[model samples]
Each structure stands twice: as C-alpha cells, then as structure tokens.
Target: MGETSDDGRLGLFGAVSISVGGMIGGGVFAVLGVVATIAGAASWAAFTLASLVSLCVAYSYLKLNAMGDNRGGSVSQLEEYLDDASVAGMVGWTLLVGYVGAMAMYAYAFGSFSVALTPPSLVDAVPLGEGLLRPVFSVLAVVLFVVLNVLGARATGLSEEVLVVAKVAVLLAFGGLGLWYGVQQGSMEYGFEQIRSVTPVVMATAVSFVSFQGWQLLMYDQDSIRDVETTLPRAIYASILITILVDGLIAVVVTSLAAPDVIQQHPERALALAVEPVVGGIGFTVVAVAALFSTGSAINGTLFSAANFAKGMVGDGLLPDETGRASADGAPQRTVLLLGVVAAVFTAYGSLDAITSFGSLAFMSVFGAMCALAVSERDHESVHPLPPAVGAVGCAAFAVLLGVHLWNAERGTFWAVLLLAVAVHAVELLYFERESIVDGVEHAEDLLVPGSG
Candidate 1:
C-alpha cells in the first residue's frame, strides 16, 4: 500500500486505474447481452449515451469533492448536505443493498463463465442439471472471497495490474479481432432498421451505466490525490473517455459479429459467443477466463470495501450494532460473513437481468439525488451552474427510463426490489428510531448554529 499524509499519494495514473478498475468488471461481460437485446446493432450507441450520463455524474462528484476535505461518499454527502439522518440511513441502506446485488451479479457471472472450464467428469458427477450447479459455484465464490477478506487480503497494485490489465488487454484483443471480422464480413451494415425505437435505446443506456460505475471511485480518494482540483477532473475525464472508446468498440463489435438471438439466450456468456466468429472454440475459453478474472477481482475488492462500509454505517447508527463487530483478526468478520450469505442467497434466487436492473436504478437514484443536492446548495464558488444542472436532469431522465424498462420488462423483479428497499428502511426505522430523530435535530442545529459541529 502507498503511504501518505492527509493528502493522497495517488497521481493521475492511480486515479485512472481506480476509475477503470472500479468499472470494466463483470458488468461489461454480463450486461452486454442485456444491452444487446435492447439495442441490437446499435448497442454501441447505448454505451455512448451511458458514457455521457457517467460524465455528468462524475461532474457532480468532482464538484462536491472539490468543496470538501472528507472522503465519505454518499452517506457523508447526505448527512452533511441534506442534514437528515433518516434520509442518510435510507440512502445508505439502499446503497448497501445495491452493492450486495452487484456482488451477487458478479458471483453469478463468475459461476456462469466457469461452466465452460468445469471438468466434464465433475459436471457428470453432479446429480442435478448443469444449470443448477451455477448457484452452488456462485455461493462458493462468495464464501471464498469472504474468507479471503476476513484474512485481510487486499488487492495490491501488482494484483490490480494483473487483474485490470489482463482483462482489458484480452477484451481489447477480442474487440480488434471482432472488428476485423465485421469489416471483412460486412456485417456492420446488417441491422440498421432494428434500431428504430427510443425506449429500448434509453433502457439499454440506463442498464449499461453499470459499466461506468467505477469512474466515481476516484471521488472517494479526494483527500489523497495531488492537485485535487485539476487532477481529479482530468483523471475522471480521461478515464471515462478511455472507457467510452473501449466499451464502444466492444459493443459495436459484438453486436455486429453475433446474432441477437444468441446474445439474448446467453446474456452472461455473450462476449464469449461473440468472439467465436474471430478465433473459433478457443476464443470461448479466452473470454470465459477473462470473465472469471474480472468477476473474481471485483468480488474481492467490493467484498472488502463493503465490510468496511457496513462498519461505517454502524458507526453512524444506520445499521444494527452487531454488523460492526470485528473478529479476532481485526476484520469486520460479522459483516463480511453476513454479506457473503446475503449475496449467496441473492445469487441463488435472482437473475442477472433483475440484479443489474435493481443495481442500476439504485445507483442512478443516488447519483441523481446527490446532483440535486449540489444544485440546491449552490454555495460552491468554483462549480458552474451548467454541469450540476445537466447532471441532475440527465440522472433523473435516465432513472425514469430505467424505471419504465423495469415496469415493462421485469415488473415482478421491479416490485420485489421496491418492497425490498422499503423493508430495509422499515427495519432501520424500527431499530434506530431514536437515533434517527436525534441525529436529524442535531443536524438541523448544526446547520443553523454554524460551527456547532
């Protein structure tokens, strides 16, 4: 780990890596099929749209970070700005649920991609169907990562390089081969009319926003980064630009080279299937391995961070005190174990499409709310009016589109996640009613009394 004072040791390279690594995980491989089903040959356009929205969200985060020295993310923002403990608790719980859902999706992706590599003997030995084994494997992956986290295993720079570089290199290679194949086969012009509707385009953009989630990770490192004002924005812009180019190329290549039915049928393995036209059977192994690495690394990092996040929430009285308990090794073992179990259960029960949808909506809603808060505050002298305005409006629009997509396509999952969010907040209210009320009053007093904190 890089040592630093209150200010960070990370430079532009570190910031960019954080942005890219946070994104470009199981999301690209898993959500590609979903977007492909929605936008067909124009999936690249969906990515472009999502990139625009990500840029806007990044703007809001950067603006907020520029105004403060603290590194706390949404929870901090809600408490400091909104000054309402109930709101912060609700948003914090929602964010936690979203992270868990994403973790489940990553676990599911790991297991699904590992299917091709599973030994035939092992596969045959299973009494249940092949599809049934995925959940088991998914649960195992979550448990394994949880144990590793409890052991204080962290993704060092070398590990990050191996994980992020290898996956990006391989995916870029696939994109190159697929692009060449598309050009030679003249499939680029094969399906223009299929991109007729706006609803699907907006929906695809919203879901694919998950692929850009990591860009905001840099925001949390604000205190550490050198030249916070200039470096932060530059890194955010550059990382998003790189992601846009890479993801756009991959989307275009996949939609051009593969059949829509094939992608839809195997959304989790769509990239693997898309690569077959270029490199044949071995290509599947290549993409599948990349998926495993991507999802594995993502699970490790998110699991470690989520455990700490749970502890932070407990410190703020947002969660039950038991969640913040540490084991003998000084790990947030309780939260880690609980998160692993919840993620495992989600993997077993939830579909990728449903999980991705719920995660996307939760993140988008959080970003939108943050942007709205920034706009309402309007105290930051450095921030311009346009970016926050655009971010707030864009986030709201995309969130609505996402909601419509859920209502139209995954209505059952939509309602289930909705009730799940309410249930989470309901528990928060029942368990922490006094704290919530007290915190809210104190927050209001702090705002009114000026320097009371």
Candidate 2:
C-alpha cells in the first residue's frame, strides 16, 4: 500500500478501475429492464441521451476534482465548492442514502436469482416468500464483498475485474438473445428512435443516468493518483464511453427483438423472453444469475468506495477525528460496521422504487453541485475543454427531473438522512472543529510530500 504522513494518492489507472467497477453495475442491467417499459423501441435513444448527459456531469466532476481541490466525493467536494459545513454534511448524508440503499436493493436482487436458480416449490419453503431468495443472496453478497474489501484495495480490485467480465458477458448475451428473437419473429428494426422521440426521451435519459454513476470513485483516494490532472479525466472518459456503448447495445437489441407487446407484458423478464426462442433454459439462467450479481456488485462497490473516502475526509479535518480511527491493518472497522448495519437495515426493507428514486436524486445532486463548482472556477485554474456553463446545464437538468419525481418519489431516505447530516455537522462545526482546524493545517504538510506510497 502507498503511504505518506497522511495518506497515499491513487494512480490514474487505479481511479479508472474503481470508476468502472462502481458504474457498470445495477445502472446497466437492472435499469434497462425497467427502462424498456417506459421507452419501448426508443430505449437506445434514452441510453444515448443518458450518455451525453453523463459526460456533462463528468466534466463537472473533472472540473471539481481539479479546482476545489477535494479528493473525496459529494461530501468533501461540496465543502470545497460551497465552503459550508452544513451543506457538506448534507452531501455526506445524501451519499449515504445512495450507497447504503443500493446495497440493500441489490441484496434483494441477489435473492431473486436464488429463486430463479431453484424451483418455486423450494422457494416456497423459505421464510420470506414463495420466491424471494434475493434478500438472502443480498446478505451473502455483502458479506463476501466486505470480506474481499477488508483483505485490502488490491483484492477488491482484482475480484471486481472478474465480476465485471462476467457482467459484460451477460449483457452481450442478453442483446444477442433479443436480436435473435426479433429476427425469428420477422420484426427486426433495431434503432434508438423507436423508443425515444426526444421529449419523452428526457425522462428515459434521467433514469438511465443512474447507469453511468460511480465515476466519482476517482476521488476516493485523492492522495493516491500519480497525476490527477491528466489521469482523472482520461479514467472518467474511458469508463463512461465503454459503459455507454454496452448499455446502448443492450437497450436497442432487447427492445427491438423482444417486441413491444412482450416487453410491456413482462418488462422484468424481457431479457428472458428474447432468449426463450433461441438458447432455451441456459440463456435464461445466464441472464438471471448474471444480472443478480451485476446489480449486487454496483451496490457493493458504492458502499466500499464511499466508506473509504469518508475516512479520508476525516483525515483532512473535514470531519471529526473519531472517523479517522482505524485498525492496525488500516481497515476503518467502525465505519465499515456502521455502513454494514445501515446497509442491512435498508436491505431488510428493500424496495426497487426507493433505491432508484433516492439513487437517482442523490447521485444527480452531487453531479449538479460539481457542475456549480466547475463553472465557478476560473479557466486559468483548469485545462477542461467544456465550460462550467455546460456542467451547470447538466446539473440543472438533473435537479429538475429529481424535483418532479420527488413529490411521488419513494426515495425519501435521502431527504431524511440529509436532515440528520445537517444536525451532525452543525454540532461539530459549531462546537468541536475549531481545535482541529490547526491540526488540519499541520497535516496539510503531509500531503505535499509526493511518492509517499
């Protein structure tokens, strides 16, 4: 592990890998199924729009990463941009809602796969329901991921790569199945327009936006990157581009091949329907099992990165010293335990509506804040090609969609959490942090010594 007086900055490639792991999960696999219902034949357009929108925010994050000089995402970055501890703590809460809630939803998703793999009769024998093995699998997945992460960052990265390959394979297979089914039915028209007519496409894009999340993982190890200026941008761009193409391929092919009626009739099983006519049971098993893991990984990765970054923020005097106390092996044991309990509580009460709603809102809010930061910064400060205005547009667009949805949004977790975060920060900033401000100053020197890793 890299080390310094404070912490080790991440390398460019490490940032990129983390971003890929986080972004490529639930947003692509589980989201596409839901989107297929709203978008029909135009699913590709929604995905395409989502991709463009993601880039705008990506620019915002790059700008934020460069300018405000914050390394941890949402929470730390918000403090840098707004210079308000209350807002920063709120950012932290929103982030917790997204990451922790995701873990719960994805855990339930894994249980769904368990039922898929076995017979309904066996599922009926279980406690939750006749067919809800997903919750069980979710807990197992969490335990497994936590263990891998505790082993160290390198272990988590290596294990995640294998999982990622499996995830992409599932997506490709889903597309091929849909394409084959569409061809057999003599109705093969694979294009983005069939589902997106630009206007309604906006809603679809907003939903798909979640699929491209996790780019902020770049900042988890702020001190770890060898060259943040060149490396961070490249990592964010490359990961987004790859994910966009993968999502597009799956969205278009599935919608085109599954047929509008089939998709609407069994939206959740659209991938299965596409494959039923071709590879039979094998294809069905592949998609169901793979999707379960893919989504689960998305949730798992988010929690892992956020917890690690929280430790960093505390180290920077941006948070209380209690947050920085870890075990000898450097595992933030208390933080992880707290995160795990939160995740499990959410998992036990898992609901897709809640997960997507809050995930979308909190995720976009962070991006919007980043855009505000990016735009406010002077150009002499950044090498970004896109202006802060562009980022702002992306940010505003996201906030509007979230506001409209918030009225009936099932994701009230973020708002509730936000209230708590504000209270916590108020207590700290108003009472506890002045003494640490000087400590923070002394620690700033530790950040200057390069190659400490």
Candidate 3:
C-alpha cells in the first residue's frame, strides 16, 4: 500500500475516496444493463436491496477489523479467529478469483464501449467481423494494464482521487440529464410503470451485488489509515451510502430513458444508448468515453490490488513462493502477469452476464462466510451478533436466488460458476493435504511390494 500522503496516513476524505473508487469502478458500467433487463422498472429497487445487503456485510467487516490488530484483511482475520489455515486459504482463493472476474468484467466493458464508439466504416473494413472485435480489444486492454503495472506506473493518491471524482461526476451528470429529458418527454410515467414484480427485482439484486464488493478493499489498507477505529467505519458507511444513491439514481434514470428490451440488446453500452435519443451523438460520446475511463481505471486498480494480495498470500505460505517474486523495481510482475492472462481469457470467452453472475456469487459467498465468522465471535463485547447474523442469512438467500436465476435462465453459466467454485476448493484441499496424501500413496506402494513384506 503506497502512502497517499507525506505522513503515510489517510484522512477521512482519502479513506472515503478509496472506498468510493473501489465500489464505483467498472461495475456499474458493466452490470447496469443486466440489472435493468432483470429488474425492469424496479431496477432502482434492486439496487436498493443490494446496497442493504452490502451495508450489513460492511458492518460485519467493520466489527471484524476492529477486533484485530493485524491489517492482513479477511484472510488474516479468518485464520486468526478460526485457527484453520485451510479455510482461510479457500476463502482467500475465492476472493482472488472474484477479483479476476471483476477485472474481466471491466475489460469486457472497456472493449464493448470502445468498440461501440468506433466508426462503422472502420469496423466494416476489418476482416474479423464485429464479434471478435470486442474480445480483441478486451485482451489488449488487459495487456496494456498489465504492462503498466509491471512498469510500476499506477494511479495513486491524488490521481486516484481525481479519477474517482471524475467518474462520479460523469455518472451523476448522465443520470440527472437523462432524468430531465425523460420528464420533458413524458417518459417518466412509463418508467414508473415498469416497476412490476418483486421476484425479478430480488434476482437483479443478487446479480448486482458484485458492484458493492469494492468497499471491502479498504480492509486491506488499514495500515495506511489514520484512526482506524473512528475513520474506517465512517468512511465505509459513507461510501456505501453514496454508492447506493448513485447506483439507484442511475438505475431509475436508465429505466426511464430506455426500454428493457433496448437495454438488453446492448447491455454493455446501455448507458450510452439510453441517452442517445435525447442528447444525440454528443451524449453517446460522453457516456462511452466515461465508460472507457471508468473501466480502464478499474482494470488497473484491481490488477494492482489482486497482484499484491497474491504476493501477501505467498508470504503467509498459502500460495507458492514463486507467485510472490517481485521485480527489481519491487513490483509483483509474475502475479500481475498471471492474473492478467487469466482475466484476459475470461474476457475473451465469457459473457458479461455470466462473468457478472460468477463475480457476484463469489463475493457473496466470501462475505457470507465472513459474517458467519463474525457470528461466531458473539462473545466479544464489541461484536453484536444480530447485524452479522442478518448479513449471513441475507447473503445465503441472495446466493440461492442467484443460483436459481442462473439455472433457470442460463444453465450453462450456472454450471460454469459451480464448476469454478468446486475447482477452487479442490485445489485448496489438495494443496493443504498433499503430505498426507503422499504418505498414503507411499503406504500403498509398500504394501504392493510383496517380496519386501
């Protein structure tokens, strides 16, 4: 964690920016249309519900952070309290995979928006056709960021603050202008009428939960924060509240500006398309550019964090030492490269919906597990069981809802997510119990040597 200030400490505003930046990343740009498609006129409701879940989860995180002196984040907390390295490693792996999913989604959005903004003549001149263009651009974006990270060029402190502020400003401006246009055109009523059925809204909430996972990144940067007990909680809560407002507002404005079918048709570029009618080409350009910047920055930030996390896990003996190897400039080049390659594969092959679903489910699982850990610490004087208990139950219900929704609508994606989860846990188990398994194999081999017996 690079210091954001001369004193190597973060103030309230800086802390809030980190949380806000984390939450506001490419998530809304990538997942907004999916939410609108599922929740329709009730997209705002879905975002609200999702934020409530995030709030509960955030409470558990805050409590857990306060209970510990180590700034090693969730993995450390899990190992410390549960006294089980295996469980911690599994959760840590899931968290890392989730971050990769997020990077893929961001890259996907960046490519989609960039391609959408390209001239039709140029696109038609290309031999690869439209289908391959997005993936090509996505992979290129991933490679670019990976190279940047390897070169130790990153947005930190003031630059990061400026980037986040610009992102929020763009989003708020688009939402506000779109809302006004909808009102002038008498489209607000139609938008209000689209809010039908609670099931789809709840399902949308499940899908949208990934957009809120960024707030948890703050847990890993506790060392850079000043007055962890006072500033951290306030920053976390304020950031979430602000994100909820922004997400809900955008949902309403988008639903108002465009029909569900329209958004579904171009889920990746929904925001730009939604505002094109009222603001014309200029509006589309602005939104598309914003999406590009937002997603690009997201890829950079997430890649950096995930690489450092892998290095940290290596230090803790949870991962192979090779992953922790740093460059002469002190960058985790290998981990960054590894993560970037995997994220590129995901971007090149996975759909926005599937990637979003997988990411949301992964984070929800980890958050639920963390809440369960919090629940187990009920004896702590400062730890209240009710908040974390509710969080655990809510996360469980949302995860089930996500599974049911995916199974019913996209069975292939559902299997992919499940298979990925199973594979991660299996690898964790194999890595942890390798010695015992090796010993068992040797015993069997000895028994087979009848002459020696």
Candidate 4:
C-alpha cells in the first residue's frame, strides 16, 4: 500500500525483501554464464568479491541516508544536490540506462527460458522459429508485467512473495542435487583455494557484484517504510549478507558439478545441467521454473523502479512532464510504459551486446555518484566497519571502473554515452532551468495527494 505522508512504510523485513527480490532477478541466470566463462573453478570466489563490493556500496548509501533527510534516495537526492544535468544528472541517467537494459534483457529471456523448458509439442504449435519467438515473447512479457504493475503495489508484493518462495526452493533443490550426485559419483572434492585465476576471476566477481545491486532499490521507497532509520540500513545489510551466502553456495555447487566447459557451452543451461544428473527429469524442470521466476521478478523490479526514477528525474526537471504523469496510485505509469517501450525496442533488435556494454558503465557511474554524494553530504565520519572513508574509496573505485569499462568494452557505446550527456545538458539548459509555473504547481500538487489505501 502507498503511504499517506511523504514518508515510507516498508518495515525492516520488507526492505530486505525488496533488495532480495531486486538482486536475484534475471542477474542470477545471465550473470552465471558470464562469470563461469571468466573464472572457471574460481567463480564462487569472484561472486564473493562482487558481494563484498556491493556491501561496500550499500554502506555508502546507509551513511548518505544517515547524513540528512533524504527521502529522495540515491538518484533523486544526487539530482537535488548535484546539477540535475550536471555530471550528477549524467550519472543518474547512466544508472537508469542500466535498469532499462536489464528490463529488456529479462523480458527477452522469458522466451529463451520457455524454449528450454517447453516441450516439443508446444514448440511445434508456434508459427515462428525459436529465434523469432524470443523477441515476440519479450514484447509480450513486458506487456504482462506492466499490467501486473498497474494493478497496484499490494498485488505486486503478493506476486513477489510467491516468486521468492518458488525461487528459493528451486535453488536449494538444485544445490542439494548437485552436491549429492557429484559426491556419490566421487567427483566432488573440498578445496581451499577455489579462486586462483587473475583477470577472469576479477571480472566474474565484478559481474556478480552488479547483479546484486537491487538492495539499493529499497532506499528509493523512502515513503513506504515504517521506520526509515531502522529499516533502511538493516534491510540493506541483511539482504546483501543473504545474497552473498546464497550466491556463493549456488556458484560453488554449479562449479563443482559442472565445469567451465559445460556452463559456457550452454550458458543458459548451466544450472539445469548441473542438477540434471541428480534431480533427473523433475529437477531440471524445477530449476528452470525457479530461474524464470527469479529473473521475472528482477525484470519487474527494474521496470517498477525505472518508471518512478524517470519521474523523479521529471519531478526534479530532468525529464519531460509527459514522462512524469502518474496513475491514481501515484505511480509513474507513463514513465514505466516509456521505459518498457524503449527496452522492448532494444530487445526486438537483438541489441543486447551493445546495450550490455553501455548499461554496466551507466550503472557504475551512478553508483559512483551515490558514493560521491555520500562523501559530500556526510560531516560526521566514523571508524566503524562502514564509514565515509570506505565510501570515498568506493566512489573512486566505481568511477575508475566506469572509465575502464567505457574505454575497454565498446568505443561506440562510450561515444553514445558522451552524446547522451550532451543531450541531457541541452535539455537542462533549454527547459529544466526555466521551470514553468504550471509544471511547478503540478509538481507541488503531486506531493499533496492523500494516501488512500
């Protein structure tokens, strides 16, 4: 339910759940293949490193929240302080781009997962080939998810509960089956240095760290929390801790049972393959179903947050008013649609590689902004486990990684980012700076809406 006041209502458990749902979304599936290709035997270690980095970022957010009343969360708050179209605004756009791409990929993945799990009879009934079905299914998946979102937060929350339960069960079953079968066949061994590789391991760890980025989503829903101070920090830390343990366990089981060759061969089939020997017919089905649910939620969360984020940009004058229009529930229904449409178009064109290249950089840039803003906002620094110094390091690391990502991956996409930044600046200069009386009045009215459950 939406909150009455401008404050949040999400409890500690709710905050943690939101992060968990966000982190496990499609990342768990897509990221697994990438990391396996990179790290091989050291995949688990890479994931662990990634988790630690995510936790570092989380701590930065906690400090930011503690510094002042930041009901606006990361991007919004950054937009407020940093020039909305300044480097700060570009950073927010970067993160939003990542969310947009992630949404598209997840929607596209729905069809691929169906093809892997659906029987031949169902495949034959389809007029299109498997390749064609993927884009069509992707578009359809986006539509269905949007409809569910429009139904309201309560329904989405219920869907999340079911999805989370099914996901956890499948992962656990897959892990158990992998451990048991591999051990029974004398193929299992306990080793100390599971991670020995260099660059590949580092890359895999980084990939896993990004996939677990959803913990920050809770901070956006500041108005939905019952107690911001207690819930926000606790929810973030707890969710990351759980993600670290669960992801490590999954990677370990998969790596031990199925080598880099197997995972890379059918990147989409790694987990299913890992448990097939032990769980046999049923286990494969279970794992596939679970993967579907997890990624689906991830996609949903991305869309959910992206729509509101765009409005945040608009409300702050970074985007157009049409993009910021809200439904009765105060949700940015139009922005959500815009993001979905953009993502669907990208999905339809098989632009995943290009999107991926730009997407990760965009996300990291915003993360750096969050850290940078945290450093700027906080006055009381402490020597606790997570402090401003750590956040400062986190910010620098994120920026450096973003630069490396931009320079190394795809020059075209990096150029595209530069162009995007210029366009953002032009918009800010032409429109955002000269806020109209109508827009400002409307924006103020938005905050005055009484929360009706």
Top candidate when judged by TM-score against the true structure: 3
Q: Between candidates 3 and 4, name the one with more favorable TM-score.
A: 3
Whole-model alpha-carbon lDDT for candidate 4: 0.65
**lDDT per residue as tens, model 2, 1-453:** 211222445555556666766665655545666667666667777777777777887776666666655565667667766877766765665566567765665665565555667787777788866234656666767776666666654434446556776676777766766766667777766544643355456655666666677776665655566666787788788878877787777776776666667765544456656666567888878887776767666655666676776675565555566754633255476666667777766665645544555556666766766666666665655545365566567656855764454444434744654454455456656544555776776677668765443
TM-score of each: 0.88, 0.77, 0.94, 0.81
Off by over 4 Å in 4: 1-8, 79-88, 121-128, 150-159, 189-194, 326-328, 351-357, 377-379, 382-453
User: Please, what are the lDDT tens digits per residue for candidate 1 over residues 1-453?
Assistant: 222334536677766766676677744777888888888877878888888877877877767766765556788777877678878887778777777877888888888887767987888888875678888888889989998887777767656755677778988899888888889987774334655766677778888876777666565566677776787789889988888787778888888878888988888888888888689889988888888888888787677766776677787777778776632344488888999999999888888877787778777777888778778757668777677777788778887887788788889977876776678668767665866678888999999998897
Question: What TM-score quantifies how close candidate 4 is to the native fold?
Answer: 0.81
Ranking by TM-score: 3, 1, 4, 2
Q: Global lDDT for candidate 2?
A: 0.63
C-alpha lDDT of all candidate models, in order: 0.77, 0.63, 0.84, 0.65
Question: What tens digits encode model 4's per-residue C-alpha lDDT throughout 28-140?
Answer: 56566666665666777776766666676677777656665556566656645664455445556556767876776666556567677777787778887666776777788
- Which parts of model 2 are misplaced by more than 4 Å? 1-16, 67-74, 78-82, 127-132, 147-158, 189-199, 222-228, 259-273, 316-329, 378-387, 403-453
Ranking by lDDT: 3, 1, 4, 2
